[model samples]
Target chain A: MSDILLEIKNLTVSVRNGKSDIPIVKGVNIEIQRGEIVGLVGESGCGKSMTARSVMGILPGPARKSGEILWHEPDGTVTDLTGLSEKALRDMCGLRIGMVFQEPMTSLNPMMRIGDQVAEVLRIHKLVRNREEAREKVIRLLKEVGIEEPALRYRSYPHELSGGMRQRVMIAMAMIGEPGLLIADEPTTALDVTIEAQILRLIRQMCVSRHMSALVITHNMGVVSALCDRVYVMYMGRIMERASTGQLFANPLHPYTRGLLSSLPRIGKNPEYLTTIPGNIPEAGREPVGCEFCLRCSDDERRCFFERPSEIETDEGHYVSCFMCQRV
Target chain B: MSEEILISARNITKSYSLGRKKRHIAVNDVSLELYKGETLALVGESGCGKSTLARLLMRLIKADSGRICFEGTDISALSGRALKPYRKRMQMIFQDPASSLDPRLRIRDIIAEPLRVWRVCPDKTEMERRILDLLDMVELKESMIDWYPRELSGGQKQRVGIARAIALDPELIICDESVSALDVSVQAQILNLLKRLKKELGLSCLFISHDLSVVNFIADRVCVMRGGVICETADTETLYAHPGHEYTRYLLSSIPAIGDDPVS
Candidate 1:
């Protein structure tokens, strides 16, 4: 039996701009197993967020999407969430599937008290029969996420809390319903190093203890190595490679993955030898005929310019979509 | 320890009254120094008063009780016109370059403002000459002289910031999270430029950042701060190789390296 909680296959997303339709997420595929952490690694404007947003059925308008987002229910039944209505989506979102957005400031309601805000989800979803039970559960959730003196913090507004504490609140809010899957999109990018480490550790710990799978979208490769067992490397709008953490770092089959690794700077190393990816991410509308990363690839092969290749499983539990990697 | 100190802070403390019985001790009794031609990194989480300490050194806010000696000058006590000359010798580059520079001013005028205000050069023509030189020194094209702050990239605007800070020829420059907003490649460029400027200008820098990897590249000495207190301080090599404090060890261990074990 497939252990996947979420499976996206050949997902294509296009947005209408001016006169023509543009494909931003050309063809992407990802799978998140139960209690598994999958790192979606890409640079800025590489459609990582789009993929995550699409999973939550929250992609903004002017964007057209196609393909299967098969979310296998806990009841052993499969559900197609792509065409769900807004109201239905809302009920499903905070209660069943929670998201920790990139910017917590935008994710949270600024004017409301954090306790009321956390309790709002329970009230909206009717998870609790009474206000007293909801209030108690909210405080418990806050304390569970490592917020100190949860009762005192319940009276504080989002603005009153520090950034690190606010993030903890966000985490607390996300875990109120104990959602089966959590999508953390650049959750620690805005945070300082120490606070970021704490958050990362917390998220990793909760994934196992809560029995919830997490989809972590970030550009930092080190975060992936630390937190993810499996990773999907996205370049432009497409997933160039997918592999277990060991196999991906040990043997990165895709050229884009290789370039990204070489470009990242390490601590206490010779700064003079730091390599850089030569070209910027391609414009959304104008994509390559073959490989999306062909222009930036160090060794652009002949087949890469003319033929688009599907993800080929060359190793067990590892896949790369590059034409060059397709050869024996 | 042999290198002559450029700046020193002895038992720096700062507190702000919150209008009640509570007084937030923003910066505790902290002591540190910057050495000539070396980068001394101040690493800490936010609310740890690292930025407040930077402001304290800049004299933006007076310390409650402490002594700041800048190159044999007890600048901590000096004020008004008495502190003017010391101000010219030291300058700061803020984190956000987009807002740091005035939106309305042209690039030439922005850089030349410091030169004119400090009277570093006599005539407008000489000022123009030096402004162009500063632009060149910061690796910015002279064609950008007519553009405003809004027209430049984050990196280019930051270059303009460097150009403005060095207009008066400061010996010590404080870069506060200068490249944290930038991508890694662009950050490397700025780091290289700063590293190179230190050599050519014989300047000392107090680099503040939350990223240990970036600090490790530039810092000769690293001081770890927590809850507005200096938890540990040592030479960069020693700090990384053998951390002394639990907080320091936690900070060091948090640095993510590729292929390393994810969890300990």
Candidate 2:
């Protein structure tokens, strides 16, 4: 029996702008060991969110998707999510795998009470038999996410809460189903620095307590380093590198990964203008024939412009999709 | 230190009544200034009345019990057409670029709105030339003037927003978290532009942001706020080197940096 709770193989995604399928998540593979945190990190339009939504079967449609998203059950049942019916998908969606979206202000219903919004998830997932029991569970969920005066907060609307508090409410709602896997998509990007750190700490601690696996989608290196156990660096919808958190940060091997790490403003080290990846991300249709990151790679060669590098195992559990992995 | 005080606020107090007689004091006993060519950063967490202070300075909202002295006049009491001259000298760049700009307006018209409203140029032809110059100043090309807000990227939209704020070449440009919406790599460009503009134009800026690193880079002096109070104010170097307030210390310690031991 495999301990991997979720496995994604050759997952390719393309946004359907009318009839054209513009690929966002290029051929990718990821495995989330049960109760482990695997971070899919990259900048905007990098397809981190798309991969998470694919696993939850919730990517906004007119999206063309391919490859296997398999969720392993304790009873030896494996469910293939890509071809699941809409009703079946919804039934398994929040209950089996809940997601905390990027912006809580948009994700949360404005008119509903915070408590009722949370209870709606519980009732939808059939976690409680009656409204009273659901209410009790909702309060407990809110309390679990560190909402003080849960009873009072339950009656408050989403707008009444601060960004951090609203995110806490969102997290509570996500956990209503006691999901095996949780996907948090840039949960703190909209918040301030102090609130961001607080929210990250809360999510990390909560995931551990619930014994739930998480795949956090973020662009911020700081957030990922603080919370994630394993890290996957993505570019142009493709996974460029994957390693344990310590290994990835200490010695990043992929050219794209090195550029991103070097670009960041390190603490206590003053530098000139941030060392940026030279060019902007290519338009979806303009994705390169070989390496999507070749245009910006400082060590780019003629071969890199023509031949796509396949993911090679550099070390146990560490993978890089780059010819210069040995040197980078 | 500059010879002239470009702008100053004296004991600015603004309060709003919450339903009954109970009032919410948004800004209380606040006083600050902007010099001829210095960036005064207002650092605070949200709901600490930073936005209120910005609005108060701009006279978007009137201060209930204080004076905003611009140049030499107490313009807090001015309204409608009376305050037009003062409005021309101070421009505000808002928090959200997407919402701050009008969806219906094209890039040219949005930047030109202030010029047209103030009638800065003698004729429409001169206004077009001036608008193009402002676009170049913010690093946007001439062709972008025709594009709508929807056509631009986040960084592009923010540049357009900056162009609009500096449209009239205002003496004081109040940027309220202008780079917060941008990506980290993109943030450097915007910050650099602001710094460059300050030196080139001898512009005074009231740079407001929660990011201490950003403020460290641009601010000549910083006023750290917590819970609607000015916790501490000093020269940027002095404040960072020896932040007296406990909250200020806590804030500095919280900034995440790789490879350095985190402040415990």
Candidate 3:
């Protein structure tokens, strides 16, 4: 039996310029299964964050969003998040679909105590009856995320904690709601490697133990390989490739995916020079008419310059959007 | 690598007074050397004083007690005019390319600023020619010369930063997390550019980064720092294969890689 948690159909996010609307996320379709850790990988400005923000109903002002963000309820009810009002979406955000941002220092309120911030989510949802119950729950959640001396740390301000500790607090805030789906955007990009490992481990443990689905958005291939069950490679606001983690690492079909993988400096492998993708990502509103990556791709062909290639399934679960992947 | 030392630092210490009573030691008594044509990396987490140490070596900040020698000359105490000549020989590429560059200046002027200050070019035509040569060297298009910093992407802005850093043809370049702010593919491109520049110019580089994988790829030697002190120093192969210090081993093991088994 297939258990689908969320389905995004033809999602397009665009921001209005002076006269024309510039699309940031163009026709992205993704499905997350129950308890599956899925990764949305892309560089900056690729609209990965915008997609995640759209799910939480948190797109910035002046950005027009269109598409069906279907959220599957356990009781067989389907909710299209795009149609919901701000009030209704706010009601469902933390309680049903939680999110964790990259910069913990800025995401958290420096003025408030760490304990109160975590407790505020419960208070907003009316999950707890009293202040005492909220405090106890927040402390337990903090301990669960591997924070040492949770009780003592509860009263500390955001500035008192380290980067890793602040991230744990953020995770605690996200998980305290016990949402079915969690969206983490570059959760460990700001931390040290050792601290990053711990945070990744905590996120994985929380998801598995609770049977929760997670949309881990990051540009790091290593993070995708270490934490994701399935991955989507995004480029210029479009999903270029989608496959299982094992399959993606073993056989990447898209030129962009291959370039990303080969460009990374592996720990044990020391090459004289890394293989590089020439040229920079095109400026907004200037993307190529055909393939988004054609300008920087070494394998681009004649068709790649004039006609956009749709997604083609290369394997049972693998899909790639590239001209070379098409079976002649 | 040859034993000819390009720069050396000995017994360098820096501290900050915290609230009049408590003191924060940013860099303890540390000593290191950079060979004439080898890339040496200083790897550590945030607050490990890697940036402070780099600043000290560049003479951007004064060390409380240390001797900084450049080509067998103690240049630590040199100030004002005496430090001017050494400044032309040691340049730095900052981590944030956007803020490090002047937003108001055109790309050509940004690259030509150092050339003008150092008086490398005598006239306007020679300056324009030199700027074009620098743009070519950094793999940036000549069309970018007239555009402002806002028009270029992150990678292109970083290239401009590199062009400015190498305008005066410095012997030693201190890259403080230079590629950390870039995407992986662009980072690889910039790394390749740096490697090519080093080989072509025979430049000595002090690469400071918190990323161990990047260090392993670029550096001939590595120094691992923790809590303002050096914990380990070794050649890249020996450091990665057989880390002498416990902290270095932990850092190596903590790196998330493609082949690593899923934590769950």
Candidate with top DockQ is: 3
* Pairs with backbone N, CA or C atoms under 3 Å apart (clashes), candidate 3: none
Per-residue lDDT of candidate 2, residues A244-284 (tens digit): 99888887898788877766645343454556665467777
lDDT of 3 by residue, A222-308 (tens): 889889999999999999999999999998899999999889888777789998787888877889999999999998889998999
State fnat for each of the candidate structures: 0.41, 0.20, 0.74
Candidate 3 CA-lDDT value: 0.93
CA lDDT of A61 in candidate 3?
A: 95
Per-residue lDDT of candidate 1, residues A183-217 (tens digit): 89999898877778789999999998988999999
lDDT accuracy of residue A169 in candidate 3: 97
lDDT of each: 0.84, 0.85, 0.93
User: What is candidate 2's local distance difference test score?
Assistant: 0.85
lDDT of 1 at A27: 72
Interface RMSD of each candidate, angstroms, one decimal: 3.2, 2.6, 2.8
Each prediction's TM-score versus the true structure: 0.87, 0.90, 0.98
Which regions in candidate 3 have their CA more than 4 angstroms from the true location? B260-264
Q: Which ten residues in a row have the lowest lDDT in candidate 1 chain A?
A: A270-279
Give the per-residue lDDT digits (tens) of candidate 1, residues B7-31: 8999999999998689999899988
